[model samples]
Target: MASASPLIDRHGRTISYLRISVTDRCDLRCRYCMAEQMTFLPRERLLSLEEIALIAERFIARGTSKIRLSGGEPLVRRDIIDLARRLGRHLGDGGLDELTMTTNGVRLGEHAEALADAGMRRVNVSLDSRDPEVFRHITRHGQIETVLGGIAAAKAAGLAVKINMVALKGLNAHEIADMLAWCADEALDLTLIETMPMGSVDEDRADRFLPLTHILDDLLGRFDLRRDAHRSGGPARYWRLAGTDTRLGLISPLTANFCDGCNRVRLTTEGRLYLCLGHDDQVDLKAAIRDGGLPAVDAAIDAALAIKPRRHDFRIAEGSAPAVARHMSVTGG
Candidate 1:
């Protein structure tokens, strides 16, 4: 077989990171992510595990170094560990540099050991609030004890954990300081993300869009924050906390656009290759692979890159439609 080509978008950005959503079904209904009632795709329509592995291998062969398995909740996918282990085979010398995952932590405790054994050095857990009531309110049915237990299990399994908190104005914004302090105490990194206008939820997204700038201003008074030049392969900007090992990462896509350095693309559960999260331009890699094999999959990827938008059109306003109709979970948050 001939060597695969590097994936470079039309704007000259080398795409080395691929986030694949293994499933579109999540257990929690985070207010910002989904509605109380969601209509998920039929399991038969989802790309088979074999198909997912094949597509992932194609990307790895084509110079993609990092692959993050994501989902509505990746842990909920059946036999997901087998798939993780299958993908883990590509994590050596000339293959993928990292195989990681992003989970809501509802099922992390049960799978942490297996995930670690599958060659994942680190994992990102989405935890917005440290308070039980706030956490339950945000996740709807999530129990803080379960998530906390999962985090502990992950730590005991020797996996480096990072907390991903979505900043919401009226909801858990007040808990940012507490979350950061807890992360520090637990030796975990915390990244704050501005609420994104993705899909339609019960409430207006503008009501919950909390600018990281406000949080930063409040934090500066409480903690000594110095700029840190650490790039974690995503859009988060890092700031080293004064005298602690904890680092606070801020992903301010609304207040501060980080599009110029964009090197990532998303693949939905059914094999749609989404070039940008904030936009809906996608290519069907599932069809490509099924109809014409890996070569066709490569062609489809190249075509998708050619049309990759320069920057996402993300805006939050009262009565304004979501930038895209798909939920963040659909695109693999």
Candidate 2:
């Protein structure tokens, strides 16, 4: 009721998608995600299900129609399924239109059925490499078969699934063709994302940065990449694979910035509402919730929307360094 004007930022962009990071803890030690030894938010500091739901309610009420649960690995959280079940209630009728999640898929095999049963619409699993050694090198002991099994389990549970592959030059870049063939054979939606220069994740990015430009060139040179319209507020550009039903997508925040169409914001596990993934600007939602509940939350959301940056500055920061120096895991990337 308080937010009658809708959640539009200064640039007139309607904020309809929200990515909520339930926990900062993760099982893998991805080379490009976070350092092997990382400090995560304490349990008491993380928002409870009630707090998460209330905050989500405020956003949904203000024209936020999409919600995606994210984390260092959401399945690592004990009550994540319960959280998903609770959050899924805010869909359809007068609530959110969709609720999905992004995960590493390490534990997906065990939780896929429960997650889908809990009302999850779909899921995106980040699997960088299909080779066991490369997967282990990128994720520090991540088993390719295990993740493949998880992906299989998710599909078996009747949930639509997508695979996210971060294209790292020299490391996993050579595997792009292999990944595409595998995804095509499996009929899985596959998206190749250029690595973001997020803090420590970018330490070797100069060497590892694999632009989607080359990948796109390869795909276009071989097959017809028919552009597809996207309804989700995500940044990935969708494409239909020629004569097949398999889909292809590219998320090139570095090479081709999609800031002008940024329809989403993120809530960190500790409750900071980040306007842009490449900036440190945030509104402290945990403080607002603790201080004044929904009234304060509404005010915080309003304040956040008022100053939300129209586009991120990941391309042109200052030096060769990334614009934002925060870790992706903690930032809820």
Candidate 3:
């Protein structure tokens, strides 16, 4: 069999992962992602399932082997199941080594089985605080029980589940130990993420941003933790609780910039491709698709890939205003 051509960027890094936002519509107004009340994109502005799949096909043909479906809230999209089935068909049975989705878990209970059957191999569910009231306070929506039930349903559906917890100082930072303990018992992968400066969360409030290093220090005194064998894909760095097989992951996006090996690219629901999360540089593939031919579309993609920044400068520098000011919900988190 002929080897698939490598999709290397200007820096010579192989790009194999693609994150496609199915819709920029999400149910929860998480304090970190959006304001208490904000306008969402009109229905007509979002990309259709067919358009998303067509882009995926083009990327797959260019050696992308992994694809993850994300959304402001993916499950909220009426025909999400159909979208998943279509993406699965394009990826084929094992054509793409990995296919997954990241969700807030609001609608997973009803959609888990269908998603798994449609060839989604694993899922990453966001659960920042296990405390119901705290969860509500952070997300502005008190749906903790529903999210937990969704996690249970996803696990029961035989999907590899990873719990994503965004630790905020004075908020859910104290729950890290407890979160890890629960994940250990449930046999789930726990990822602790530091807050980013992009959302409605004020820059001053971002000072309360909890770094993963502090969490590690706190855990070291409580449990024996050891760095685990490194994995190729995904952003988090994995480590195991010393005595058990249960593993924990850390995403210190604020402090640690993993841009040198950024094997992934993000496509907004509306057809814009962003090279980095912290910067506003994006390519408008949707307009190209409508106005230009396939060559034009591919050229836009290549241009985006060529200009992919060496790394996101979030430390010494401030965040840039996005070329498209659509919030995380519209851009697909």
Point to the candidate with the largest TM-score.
1
TM-score of 3: 0.92
Clashing pairs in 1: none
Q: What is candidate 1's lDDT per residue for 141-221, written digit by digit as tens?
A: 899999999999999999999999999988998889988888888999999999998888999988899999999999989
* Backbone clashes, each candidate: 0, 0, 1
Q: What is the C-alpha lDDT of each candidate?
A: 0.92, 0.84, 0.80
Q: Over the stretch 129-200, how does candidate 2's per-residue lDDT look in tens digits?
A: 888898998898788888888999999999888889999878887788778778878878889998777866
What value does the lDDT take at residue 31 in candidate 2?
A: 87
Name the runs in model 3 displaced over 4 angstroms.
1-5, 90-94, 316-326
Q: 47-159, model 3: which lDDT tens digit per residue?
A: 77877777777788778888888878888888889978877875564457777899999999999999989988789999999899999998897589999999999989998
In the predicted model 3, the residue pairs found to clash are: 26-72
Query: How big is the positional error of residue 25 in model 3, measured in Å on the Cα after superposition?
Result: 1.7
List the lowest-lDDT window of 10 residues for candidate 1: 1-10
Sorted on TM-score, best first, the list reads 1, 2, 3
The deviation in Å at residue 90 for candidate 2 is 1.8
Record all residue pairs in model 2 with backbone atoms less than 3 Å apart, i.e. clashing.
none
Model 2 sits at a Cα RMSD from the real structure of 1.9
Candidate 3 C-alpha error for residue 315, in Å: 3.8
